[model samples]
Target: MSLLIIRLLVFVLVFWAGWRLWQYWQGFQNQRVEEQQGKDGHESMVKCEECGLHLPSSEAIQSGKLHFCCSEHRDAYNTPPRDDKDN
Candidate 1:
């Protein structure tokens, strides 16, 4: 009877250890996947040439090689400055 009890306890202990290991492995895999997704979803930041505002490239307005925070800024930057001497 004692031998049987010991065998049962060992089996339970092994099963518990295996279950814990499986749980840990699943958590590790989930963390890795989350990190990968974060990296893939990252957007590059750009500076607006007009206002010097920093924002994601996806949201910035692009005019040739320059970036702007808004249409007004883009227009303001693109328009040539008035010459006071000529006026």
Candidate 2:
């Protein structure tokens, strides 16, 4: 009777461990899916006119129809290059 009880206890422990492992695996999978969904979310992407770097439109600086990564890039793009040959 003691041996039978020990066997039953072991079985219950194994089942509990398996259930915990399954729960952990499911949580990990769900977290990965949520992260992937965040990366592929509805926000549109824009390219910087000066550096051509791509970033989310919401973070970009917009000047008229042009989009830039930062204010410096926008200013640089708007300013014409100085002519060294003309001097």
lDDT of each: 0.91, 0.91
Q: Which stretches of candidate 2 lie over 4 Å from their true place?
A: 1-40
**Residues forming the 10-long window of minimal summed lDDT in candidate 2:** 34-43
Candidate 1 C-alpha lDDT tens digits along 4-68: 99999999999999999999999999888767546765667899999899998878999999999
**Looking at candidate 1, what is the lDDT of residue 44?**
78
Model 1: how far residue 11 lies from native, Å:
31
What is the alpha-carbon lDDT of model 1 when measured against the actual structure?
0.91
How far residue 34's Cα lies from its native spot in candidate 2, in Å, is 13
Give the lowest summed-lDDT range of ten residues in model 1: 34-43
